[model samples]
Target: MCSRIEDVITEKARTALLQVLGPLPWLEKAQGEVRPTDQIQLIRPYKGGHELALARWGFVSAGMGTAALKKYAMFNARGETLSESRAFGPAFRTQRCVVPLSAFYEWPTVDGKKRKTRMSRPDGLPLLVAGLWNRCEGSEGTVESCTLVTRPPTSDLLSVHDRMPALLLSKDLETWLHGTPEEAQTAALTSWRTGVLQMQAV
Candidate 1:
């Protein structure tokens, strides 16, 4: 499950990124320590165009109180059940999005102890992970949130964890954002090649 991430790009880097990934919405700095419920940068297809928005990174159940949310973790949705989960099904079909991050954190059991691990693109480029988003109304307000879609692990990633976030590489991003849900699901199942995704103990 992708629960924490790093977005260590500088402001200048973010500006350059915006040009390539923009028509972004107004948002504050998101260049480090991203966690569940934090405002995260996401891009979604809308009205024949792409717009970047500051989206919360966890799915909030409708009408759940704030206190309940504090103890809930809906940051990762399993891709195998994308069409089956009540909370994520509709969003997966219609509100698909991509999450941008430099790297994501994981905890893997090694030598009988769990250790912090970091997974990133070997090329140092930012990654766009597949996701589903929703806007739910509650007593507090209308909360817009998202969840990463995870797939069964690639052989390379299996050493770190049994699952990895469904990533949309440059070659597949456009189709994933614009294709039908069935197409997107098929695309997401194509796992990353060995040596493309780097993992290290942190």
Candidate 2:
């Protein structure tokens, strides 16, 4: 299963990203909590290259209660099903965003024993995971939440799990965030094949 990754963004990483993804007032107010309407961050680093872009939080909705507990919390949507799934189709058509992380966590089960692994770039850069967002009205009030998109793992990620977050590159962030339906689909289907990500036992 996928979980929060460790390795803080720190002041340097945050400041660097802000310089690249300018005019992002929302990021100044961002904290670590996964709240509705909170700004999600995105950073894209190329293979053996510098970071491409940094984005502030976007919006998304999480399934509540039974839906959340049982149905994966809408944290990830399959890239292959973006054009088909009812819950994700609309978001795929519009409202796409990027999620930044220095690392992410996944649990591996070997011989009935579970082990946690931390995945991150070998060069210590950020990884950009594709995301979708939507606003929903709840009894409490209006909330915005987001879900990460997933696809078959790249060769580098297969040892950890069958699926990995759909990682986006700098060249495609604009299209993924503001492209037509077909463009979004093409961008989503592209494989994440940059930076050597390391999976260490945590």
Highest TM-score: which candidate? 1
TM-score of each: 0.86, 0.74
Report the lDDT of model 2 for residue 54.
Answer: 31
* lDDT per residue (tens digit) for residues 1-202 in model 1: 7788876654654664566566565355656668887788777887777877667888876776878778878899888788888878888878888877788889999999999988887766776788888888877677888888888887877778788888776677766677787788877777345668788888
lDDT of each: 0.77, 0.62
Off by over 4 Å in 2: 25-72, 110-112
Residue-wise C-alpha lDDT for candidate 2, range 95-165, written one tens digit per residue:
67667666777787867887877787776666667777666765667666667787788777776788887
CA error at residue 34 for candidate 1, angstroms: 1.9
